[model samples]
Target: MHAFIVTGASRGLGYALCQTLLDDGYFVVGIARNAGPALEGLAARHPERLLAVNADLSDAGQAAASVRTALQQLPLPECATITLINNAGVVTPIAQAGHYPADEVVKAVAINVTAPLLATDALLSATGGLPARRRVLNISSGAAAKAYPGWSVYCATKAALDHFSRSAAVEQEGAANPARVVALYPGVVDTDMQSSIRGSDEVQFPQKARFDALKADGALSSPADAARKIVDHLVSPDFGRQSVVDIREL
Candidate 1:
């Protein structure tokens, strides 16, 4: 049996990925600040296979503890593989760097960068003796490689995550039970994050028009579609071959 851990599992890509994993009979630990009705319903149907953990990713302590708890209670007798997807992120404080709120800046970094690293560290320490095929997937974005006027915080955070994956993968090389790490760009999905981007102040986000056009042109992938593509890559033999990947390139 496969065991999976997903963060930001309340809605959007995270929720869809949890549902997809559950439907395939995989054990899933879902961590979210709030579990919406859809995820709650899925949890109800598969209580044994799906574990729901409530944690605020904005809080570093909560973020790390959630991973420990998720791994601790994971039924591991038949688990053959374990994958951790750090999918929770914040695309906020959508204003120019100088005008950005300090609090929002901190929150963005906590969610986008620190949480994933902490979660990866926690999972590594907790699962050291589990002897399973382990992988850490950081849900990244195109913004990691591009510069957006008002997304300095978001871009910097994602870039940090991508670089972290590269370094972690190297560090884990040749270990007895090493875990593969990859930071993947999942493309522009029609999630709440996109909606928030569309609503940004034009003065703050000059590229708002481009994103608006993507939505208007019906080019954004649906959450479920994106989730499926991502899971396919997650379970693929070629997964983690590239430390940093753009799903669109696959």
Candidate 2:
């Protein structure tokens, strides 16, 4: 069976990805801070295929440990494919760079940047010798390329992730068993992060109206739809041709 390791699987696109992959007959390891009701229902329905792991990725040690645990959960018949979706991210304390607390900035970097880096390292290390098609998908955003009024930290971290993907792809060139890595931007999805952005103070986030208008005009894609599109692209022949992908283009 194929094995998919997905972080932030309690809700939003991460949760939808798990549901979709499981439906397509892949074993999924879902990592999240809390085991919400939705994930619990999924686990109850597919106990053998879905493994829910409660972990706080903000802790530096948690990423590697979580990956190791997920690998242990793989059933017999071994794994034909291994995919790591670094989907956990946060946009908290929305305010001007100077106005936000230093600790909040650190926390945001920990969750958005540090965790993914560590997780990727662990995944490659654990699956290096396995004769399976390996892939890593980093959930990135448009903020990585565009500058937002109060999203300095978020933008910086996502840009970092994109660059990391690019460098990793280059490093994998000519390797015997190379893992395809891509930083994917999932357009504007109607997730909890959107709600947080829409509720932000106008002074801090000047782009609030744009996001609010996106909701009013029904422009944001649903998590399930976005997840389907992303997974479709991941499995496509052209997946790894580009280190960075914007879902809207696909």
Candidate 3:
């Protein structure tokens, strides 16, 4: 059986991705702070295929432990492929760098940057000699490329994830069979994060009007649609052709 480990699986794109993967007959180990109603419902339906792990990805120990728990679900000889989607992220404390809370910055870095690295490490260590194809997909954003006035923390974390994928790709260049790592930009999806951005203080987040306009123009992609597009890109022929990818380009 094919297996996928998806972080942030309780809601938004993560929840949609879990639903899509289960429909495709893949076993999914969902890691999230809270296994919400959607995931709980899916678990009820796919008892054997879905494993909901209530985990706080911002905690280093929990992030690593979640991967270990996922590995335990895939017993020897039965698992065909292992895919890790680092989808959990935060875009908070939207203010000038010095004005943001210190603890919030730390939390953002922990969840958005450190957790993916720790999860990726555990995945590679556990599946190194297995015949299964390993793939690490980081849910990145356009903020990684452009500078947003009040989103310094969010932008920096995404940029770090993108560079990490690039370095991982370089390290796998000569391997006979290497784990594919790609930082995926899912575009502007209509998720809770967008809601948070729209509700932020206008004085601090000057780009609030832009997000509002996107919503007014119906330009935001739905999480379900984004999940379908992302899943299609993940299974595409040219998946690992580039270490950094934009869903629009797919």
Better candidate number, 1 or 3, judged by lDDT: 1
- For every model shown, the clashing-pair count is 0, 0, 0
> Which rank order by lDDT, best down to worst?
1, 3, 2
Q: Write the per-residue lDDT of candidate 2 for residues 82-122, one digit (tens) a residue.
A: 99999999887788878887888888898899999899989
lDDT of 2: 0.89
Instruction: Please provide TM-scores, in order, for all candidate models, with all chains considered together.
Output: 0.97, 0.96, 0.97
Model 1 ranges with Cα > 4 A deviation: 36-38
For candidate 3, the TM-score is 0.97
Candidate 3: tens digits of C-alpha lDDT, residues 1-250 = 7899999999999999999999888899899988645588998888889988888988999998999887886773687778999999999878777789899999999999999999998998888888888899999999999999899999999999999999988887776669999999999999999999999988888999999999999999999899999998897778889999999987
Q: lDDT (CA) for every model shown?
A: 0.92, 0.89, 0.90
Lowest-sum lDDT 10-residue window in model 1: 34-43
For model 1, which pairs clash?
none
lDDT for 230 (candidate 3): 96
After superposition, the stretches of candidate 2 with alpha carbons farther than 4 Å from their true spots are 36-38
Report the backbone clash tally of model 2: 0
Output the TM-score of candidate 1: 0.97
